[model samples]
Target: MRTFEVPTRDQVSPEAQAIFDNLKKQVGMVPNLYATIGQSANALSSFLAFQGAQAKGTFNAKEREAVYLAVSQINGCDYCQAAHTALGKMNGFTEEETISLRKGESDNARLDAIVKLAQDITENRGRASEETVEAFFAQGFDNAALIDLIALVADKTLANYVHNLTQIAIDFPVAQPIEEPALV
Candidate 1:
């Protein structure tokens, strides 16, 4: 199989180059995943907009990272697993806690609800069980929060599928392997 090389800034459209520059200025470097997405003329911008809009939602940084970790784990996206593990830690999740989140649980009941719902959504392809939806709301999430969760799942799903299809080189610290659950 051929490797998909991440395109350099100069190799992409000027609009993508600007996004790349902003990524470098903010994050210190263009991560391989972001650079790879920049290969599309507008995908990178759309992705950034979606990601940026998530912060305005009800979930905090920790909760959002939990969503990322849970979806990445369910999809078995090694690239995202590694990336979100580091991001999870930065957002106050311990390594052990991050692993637990990957397994669709958390010590905190509220967060566990979030992770469980995210896992269900991914595993069921958006047909999350009514109980799971109820549990999510019982954890203090409103309808708007649920919508944001779904949006986050959709955003992360795009990244998960991209990495799965491309088998992109992971730029984050290596995540330990876990057996992927069989798809239903």
Candidate 2:
């Protein structure tokens, strides 16, 4: 099995080093997963641009975090699960709510619809069921919101796949695993 190391500011290209400095300034510390991405000459910056562009979308911070949590959970990316759990809390989701979102359910009906659709889209490889799509629309999401949601899923999935492949150390508090309900 191959092992991947998280690159330091000194170990990466000048562009990635600048990104590391900016991330450190903004986030306090460079996350291990971001550091790993920094190993590439431009991946860190490209990812930052892609991630930053989400703010222009219809989903607010909380909704975006919800999608991220659900998608990360579905993708089994421990790193993103931890990261987004913290981010979700910052975006006003209680810890329990974050857990629920990760489980592809939520106490908020609209948020539940969002997570369910996100999970379905991820698990079904972008082919969400008509029922799920209707439920999402029923929750007041328009076609633009749907497009934004899909973009959010794709963005989150990129980090998920990177962390899954690299198995980097998580920088945030580790998220508790969701227990599966027993079969009746």
| Candidate of highest lDDT | 1
- The list of candidate 2 runs beyond 4 A from truth reads 181-184
Residue 122, candidate 1: Cα error in Å is 0.9
lDDT of 2 by residue, 1-184 (tens): 6988888788999988888898889979998988998998587788889888988888889889999999998899999989999999988889989888888887789988999999999999999999999999999889999999999999999999999998878889999888972110
Q: Against the hidden reference, what TM-scores do the models get? A: 0.95, 0.95
Q: What RMSD value applies to candidate 1?
A: 1.8
Judge candidate 1 against the unseen true structure and give its global Cα lDDT, from 0 to 1: 0.89
Taken over the whole model, the C-alpha lDDT of each candidate is 0.89, 0.88
Candidate 1 Cα outliers beyond 4 Å, as residue runs: 179-184
